[model samples]
Target: MSTSRMPLALRALRTLLWILAVFGAVGLALGLVGLAVMTEEEVVRETGVGRSASMAALLPGFALVLVEAYLAATLIRGGRARRWCVRVLAVLTLLSGLLGLLFLDVAGLFEVAVAVLLLALHESRSAREWYRSGTETGKPDGAVPAPTG
Candidate 1:
């Protein structure tokens, strides 16, 4: 199918993923800069947090950004693997949100929102049709109806 005819759900999901990837990248860059410019002693003095704790916190976020970037690419290209990736990523995101909640962090709300949006888009009728069509062709909505005899 032409890009113009693509499902709205797929388009929304792709857009959301890209937005998340960009934000995560920006956050990671800022984090790296903060780390570079500040000493462990300074961090402890300023925020009562250790440098090791900050580094540990960023690692999972960095991993999440990598996953979001990969998922965005897979969603565009469309394959059976993309379906699996969506499911797995959604589950992981949900788990992350739950962990955040356990820690009483407001950031958990964002993670939960991302997971809900991801699942909702994947499960929409239009997106499912789009994925089914793509799976048949192993290409991004490339399945075409047979010509009339």
Candidate 2:
């Protein structure tokens, strides 16, 4: 990705991804703390799930959240592959969010919204051409090239 004249979609996606990562991490931490504070019997009585089971359930989410953070970090550098990375990650996020819904997680809605926005932004014409141009010039499609000496 060109540092200069980066597409608004990319900029927004990158920022949003990082924000999602932060929120996910915070949520996970809170969940863990809540679990830790609860007695095993209380956990079973309250949620019909054991503490260990709940901890196990959180592992995949933590992994995926880390991946989201990684994707955001990747966007900070120059690469042709970042566009495809964003697309694939966005789909994963959407599916993950849908899976979260099955567990009655309200946070899933935020995940879905961000994923949908990421899809729309990255799929925009300007963003596509920006990736396609593959030049450091930072001009997306047909902008006039600087006259070389």
lDDT of 2 at 40: 99
Q: Which model scores highest in TM-score?
A: 1
TM-score of each: 0.78, 0.75
Residues 1-149, model 2: lDDT tens digits: 24346677777877888988898899999999999999999988977899999899999879878887987776644366776777888898899789898899997898799789989987888777766666355444456767779
How far off is residue 124 in model 1, in Å?
A: 0.8
Model 2: number of backbone collisions: 1
Q: CA shift at 91, candidate 2, in angstroms?
A: 1.6
What CA root-mean-square deviation does each model show from the true structure? 4.6, 5.3
Colliding pairs, model 2: 1-79
Query: Candidate 1 — what's its lDDT?
Result: 0.81
Q: Rate the local accuracy (lDDT) of all candidates.
A: 0.81, 0.79
